[model samples]
Structures are given as C-alpha cells and as structure tokens.
Target: MDFLKLPKRTSGNRTYGLTSIADFGTPIGRLTNILDDYSHIIDIAKIGIGSAYITPNIKKKVDLYKEYNIKPYCGGTLFEKCFYQKKIPEYLTYLKTLGIDWLEVSNGTLDIPLKDRLNVIEHAKEEFHVIAEVGSKDCNLEMDITKWKEEMQIFLEAGCEYVITEGRDSGTSGIYQSNGQVKSELIEELVKGMDVKKIIFEAPTSKHQMFFINQVGPNVNLGNVKLDDVLVLEAQRNGLRSETFYLEDADANYVNQTPTH
Candidate 1:
C-alpha cells in the first residue's frame, strides 16, 4: 500500500472532529485504571447521566479529569432532569463550584421548547462550556429532519460549541435500530446540506463507527465511546486498522493491477 493513499487523521486535544468517552463505572477507581494506560488518547471524559450522584467524591474525579487535561462534564439526562425540576440554574452553579467548566444540555427525556432549550445553553455558558444534544430517549420518538435543523441552529447560535447527534449510549434506538444499527439513509440525509463538522455522532459500536468513518470520512466527531474501545476507534478514524479500510485497499489494488484485461 502506498503511504500517500492513506488519509491523515486528527490528533487528540482537538476542538472540531473531536471524540469523547463516557465513564459509567466506579468513578475514581475506574478513572485511575483508564489513565494508568489510556489517558493520553482521550479528549473528553463524561460522568454519564447522574453518575456523579452515585459517586460521592465528584470533586475528586473532577480534579482527576483536569489533571490529565481531559474535560469533565455531566451527561445530558442530568441536565434534562435539572431543567425539568426547575433547578437548571442551580445545577450549573453547583458544577462550577466543583471546578467543572463543561456542561451538557439535552432534551432527550423531556419536551423542551426551542426557546427554552437555547436559554439553557446561554445560561450554562455564563459559567461553563456548553454542548447540546440532539435526540429523544423514548423509543416512540420519530425522525423529523425539520425539527433537527431548527434545534441545531438554535443551539449553535446560543453559544454552544457542539450539537451532538442522537445515537444513544448503544448507538441505537433514536437514530438506530433495536440491534444497534444506524439508519444509514436517514444519517446520510441528516448530514446532507448541513454542517457536518459541528455535530458529534454517539457511536458506541464498531459497526456504527465504521459506517460513519466511511460516509463522513475519518475525521467525523463521535461520542459515548467505552474507554476500552479508545484505541480501536482511533485506528478506525485514522485508517490505521479496521477491515473496512483493508477491503477498500484490496479493491483498489485489484482495479489498478496493471489492467491486463
């Protein structure tokens, strides 16, 4: 394989085309175990969905994430609950007190109005870095491209740095099937005529990661990745490994084999 044929992939500590991980296990111990080997590869560390509540030493973990320069933030479900419970402002303020500079605002489990959602983003930005999510947690929720575009625009304009696409924790359910497969036609259409760079797709499965890297190129943003999948996902993104790139190389070699026929 010629070296130039392979595409160049982005390094970590990136803003755009970024990748983030979810910390779903024991907060401090798990963090120690992962960083003991893989901290340099990770960009963002998420205390996924109220895990901070379960882990009483939120401040300790927050400091650990920062010690590695890995941004620590809460998951969207917590933000949704706070906003729904009329404690949105309090949540943002409390996170700041704990040395957290990032927060996620999502409407996954609730129906937040477009204006209200943007308002949360703005309020969050006053004290923290904000990233908004685009998806529904309910299985009954259907795809509405118009709604997606509108919400994306509002969030981006509200000073949120990134608007994440809905792939759920398993990369399924909202924009995927029960078997954890993404609806490719819909994914292509969703990315069509839109800013592909600003959105992060939550792709927890290898198949989903391969598909996105194929369609949107290796530099696509992804989230909800398990800590152990870090190296594998990075290889896929950079064309370093993964069968998809191998197959592509094989096909190209066949086509260019001196063209005897």
Candidate 2:
C-alpha cells in the first residue's frame, strides 16, 4: 500500500495551511464515510450555513470529525445571522453543546464594524479556534487588494488562527470575478508583502481548486471543498491527477532512450 510514495501533505492538526471541507447537509452516515475514507487529508469540516440545525445527530457528527483530528465548526454566515438576530450568546452556547471549539467570524453579508470584528476575534480566541474571514460576499461590495491585505493583517493581529479569502461556495465573487475566474494580479499582489501561508482561499470548484494549487503550490490553504471531493483534491495535491501533472517529480532512475542507427 505504501509502494507509490506521494508528496507529503500538511498534517491535519497543523496550526495553519489547512484544507477545509464544507459539509453541506450530508447525512451522518455519508459524512462519517467521507471522513473514514479521507480523514488524513481533511483538516476542517465546516458545518456550512445554519444548515447544521437540520442535521440529525449533529453533535455526534461533530464528535466523529474531531475523533479523526478534523476541526468541525459552523460557517460564518450562521454566526452573522445569529449576531443580527441577537442570538450571539445563544449561538455560542449551542456550539459549546455540540462540543465544537472552532469558530468562523465574518461579515460578508452584513456590515460589521472593524472594532467589533476585532473584538469578536479577541473574545472568541479565548474559548475557540477562530478563523476570521475578510471580503464581502456581495459581488458589488468589492474591496481592492490593498484593503483586503490590510484587513487580513488586522484580523491576524486580532488573534485569528487563519483568515479566509471570501470566494463564495459558487466560486464567484470576493477574490474571484463573477465568472469564477481568479483575479491573478490581485492574488499576486496580496501575497507579495504578506504571510501567504496564513491565508485560506475559498475555492469550491475543481477549476478554482486547480488554479490555486497551481499558483500557490499544493500546501496552499483551501476551503469550501465538498465532502465528495476530498480524495480527488488530495490526488491533485499530490500530482496524481491530469490537472496537476506538472507537479509530478521526474523519474530519477530513467535513462534517455534514443534509437541509434
């Protein structure tokens, strides 16, 4: 089983540079099956949106993900909704009840004051592993790369373990154009003067995943990966897929075969 050695992937428990998967209402059995099949490559299992509420045995599912060393937590939209509904405290209590220790704090849909966002980061860090997200989900509410860089810096300083670049689950908006194409110039500029490793890109589609992996290498932190795509993503990460063929290491033992007259 160990004969075909592949590139080393970052450990699931590694503090940064993670592969975060979105659990979009998958039944517990399927969720556990995915984890059982590809736990080694999955770092975080995000309970996307408020959909966790409808999931049966959600707590057990969270615990199962944890048992595999995958940090499971609700999405930032769920937090945003709770905050606007005056249920931040209740949400925190509910998360605790689920035995989840990771939290995603973001204001993609609503406008949250910088001071307050930082305050939440400060507060959440005390009880949870906070991953703060930057950028607005609305395509019209775009920020330039410079401002995105500055905001990510502030969130990191505010004690967030990692910051997510908002590319909506559809692979549109935020760091990407409405057409699902990445702003290459923007991405290059943002990583130039920043700790690129600390940024997790939300690349939900295979195209988006391949683009980021090609641009930033295999260990580049990626998010919003679907449950079924974990192994496929891992294959791409290790140059085992056609899209990543350029990443494959050359055969060291090969000799040039030339037909001589």
Candidate 3:
C-alpha cells in the first residue's frame, strides 16, 4: 500500500504516542472487528471500568488483542472495587486468569491515602505493567497542580510504567473542566518537571485529544479513547485530518492528482 509520506510517529509496544481505547461492553466479535483494521494505531485495550466482569469470552478477547500486538488491561474502577472489597489479592489472581498483563490503579471514586496508593502500585508492578492514575473523578473536587505533580512522581517511583491524568470517559472530569474543556493551566503546571512521554493524558474527545497533540506535539501519549474514534485520532496525530492538516505540506502534484476509475 503506497500512500503519501507522513510525519514520523512512535511505534507500538515501545512508548510515547500511545493511544489507549476503552472496550466498554463491546462483545468479543465486535471488538475483533474494530481491531482488525485499526489495531496498528492502538497501543492498549482497556476493558473500561468494571465492564470486564460482564464481557463475553473475556479471555478470548484478551488473547485476540495480544494476537494483534495490542495489550489488554482493565480500567482502574476494577481495582478500586477490589480495594474497597478487600479482594485485591483475588483481583490480581482473577486478572492472571484472564491473562491480563497490564493494570490500572486509581482512587478516583474512593478516597485512598497516598501511602496505600503507592503500596498498591508497588505490589501490582511485580506481576503486571502498571499504569497509575492520579485525580478525582468528581467534577466538584479541585486539585492543586503542584500536588498532582508530586503524586505522579511518587507513583512513578513506586513502579508504575506510565502515569495517567484522570480524564474520565465523559471527558468532563479530572484534567478537564465540568464542561469538557482542557484546563491548559493545570496541564502547563503538570508538565513542568514531569516527563511528558511517560504521562498518558486521558483525552476522550477529539477536542481534548487535539489540544494535547497540538500543545505537546504529535507524540503525546493519550488514553481513554473510544473504540470508534481510533483511526480519526490517528488522522489528527498524522495531520491527515482537517484540524491538523496544516502540519503536512503535500506536493502540489499529489494534491491536485485526478482520480482513476
């Protein structure tokens, strides 16, 4: 497939430019179909927020992602549930059973102490690739960026491979305002001393994703993407979409070429 040349982007299985999507309630067959053509742009498949419990052929779905080089993992809500139920050990074992190699740990819905959160990260790292998420899911809650940065560092040191800034599936909580706008000030402060590549900004919408891609360049790692939006997001990343088409300076001949039937 000879296509027009485009800007260089990071490869999968490595790091940076990562695109993680949520598989919330999608059946295994439909999930396979989604990944069949677009898995090349997807880095991870997250069974969003406890939806793993009800997914049909869960193990089969996990294996299918692995078949296509896409890592499969659970959302942080499953971890929060196990923590509140005092079944973390059981949860880990269950993930093992499901063949999940990645895990997301967050206290978005529950109030967890820093020490305990770090401990959770420390332990989960032993058996899985951990992604530590920091921020509250409640739109009414406020957080200082300085504190957010410090906590992210702590989680990183605790064995987390990547840190996710909480931007809930609705794109209205955490790093975003209740109205779904990205808080540029907070983002500016959060990246002051942090490795932007090691951070996965939870950008669930095109606007939010475009903001990060533009502000941080095309290699910014993004998460919580919906299954239907993967290729569209890739288009934005590669400047193939209208929002970012200016980044590409196509040859006039190619741009003006007539179509052949």
Candidate 4:
C-alpha cells in the first residue's frame, strides 16, 4: 500500500482526521464486531442523545470502547437534560461510575447563557477532557457569524479540548441549511485565523463528508458519523472514494498521463 501514493492520513493516536461515531444503543456484540475491525479509524464513540442514560450494560459498553483506545462519552443532550433537571453534579458522578473520561458540553437545544456555559466548561475541565459544541439544533434559529466565532474562541479559552460545530445527526442544522447544503461562506469565515484542528465538524453523510474533506483537506475532524460509514469515510479521507479521488495532493502524476503500453 505504501507503493501507492494517495492523500496522507494522520495515523496513530490521531489528533486530526478523527471520526466520531454516534451509537444509538448498539448491542455490545455488534459494537465489539465494529471495534474489532474498525477501531483504528475511529477516535471517539458517542452514546447518542439520552440513550446513554438508559442503555443496558452502559458501563460495560463504555469500558469496551476504552479497551479499544476509543474515547467514549455520552452525548451533550444528556448533559443538557441533566442541566435542565439541576442534576449536573449527579451526571458527573454517573459518568465517573461508567469510567468515561470525556465530556461533551453543548447548548444546542437549550438556551444556556454564556457566563453559565463558560463556568460549566471551566469546572468540568478539572475532571474530564471537555468538548464544547456551538450552534443551535433548531434550523430556524439563526446564529450570527460573529457570535459563532466568539463563542468558539471563548470555549477554547475556557479549557475545552475541542469545539464542535453543531451539525446534528440528521446533517441538516447548525452549519448546514435546512436542505442539508453546507453554508460554505459561514464555514470559511469561521475557520479564518482559527485552528481547524480544534474544531470537529459534524458530518454524518457522504455529501457532507466529501465537502469537508475537499474544503478542509483530508485530516479534518468529523463527528456524528453512523457506525457503518467509518470505513467508507476513511477511504474518502485518503482519496480512495470517487468523490475525493481528484484531491489535489492525491498523486496527480497519474492524471492525464499517456500510456507507454
């Protein structure tokens, strides 16, 4: 494979080209099967939404992900639910009991004030690696571009390990329009003068994945990916898929070349 030149990927405990899968109560056996084959390409596993709260054998599931060197965390919606119920302390205890060391702090479905959100992130950093999410899940709720950048910067400064742009599992909110088309201008503006590595764009579909790969290069972090799409996404990242086969760095010498035979 080394003899074939393709887009290079950041390998071995990758800081970029991260693919985070959303697990919606996947049975342990199936999860194990997936990890057995694809753990190397997966960086994180999110117990999607509030399912982590009631998933059977939740602790074992979390431990299994850790065994494969994957950081497993409950979705931020669970955290927001706890916040709404004034059980933030209890939620942290629950996560610790499950042996999960990563946390997602998001306000997608809630209207948590900036001050409170910052305080939550600052305090959570003492116990867990925090990933803060920006943008609303509600498609009709428009967030100003300036506010998006400001909040992202503020979250990073407040000790967030990474900032996530809210493209829900549906791939039709936050940075994307209602029709699932990416707001390209907004994305370009948001990344200007910012460390792209610190931001994980939620790309849950082929179109979104291809766009991010082409626009942000192969090493961009992607989130909210379905369990089955991990291998294909990795292929696209390395220019092995038709959508990204023409990536500029993908051994262009093979293109438009005359055949000696």
lDDT (0 to 1) per candidate: 0.75, 0.81, 0.84, 0.87
lDDT score of model 2? Answer: 0.81
Q: Tens digits of per-residue lDDT for model 1 on 1-261?
A: 665455544555766556688888555786688787877767787888877766787899889889987888888888888888899878877887889888888878888877798777766687778888887877667868777777777788789888888777866576787667677776777677466667888888888888877777666778888888988887776576745565333323221122110
- Residue 143, candidate 3: C-alpha displacement in angstroms: 0.4
| Cα TM-score of candidate 3 | 0.92
Off by over 4 Å in 4: 248-261
Rank candidates by lDDT, best first.
4, 3, 2, 1
Off by over 4 Å in 3: 1-5, 248-261
Tens-digit lDDT string for candidate 2 (1-261): 677765455563675546899888888777777777788888898988778877888888888988998889999889999988888889888989999998899998989888887877787789998989988888877697789889999888888888999998897889999888898888887767677677899999888998877777667789999988888888887778898776644322111211111
Using Cα atoms with residue i matched to residue i, what is each candidate's TM-score against the true structure?
A: 0.87, 0.90, 0.92, 0.94
Best by TM-score: 4
| Model 2, C-alpha of 49: deviation from truth (Å) | 1.2
Q: Candidate 1 regions off by >4 Å? A: 1-6, 246-261
Candidate 4 accuracy as lDDT: 0.87
Which candidate leads the pack in lDDT?
A: 4
lDDT of 4 by residue, 46-88 (tens): 9999999889999899989999999999999999999999999
Q: Judged by TM-score relative to the true structure, which candidate is superior, 1 or 4?
A: 4
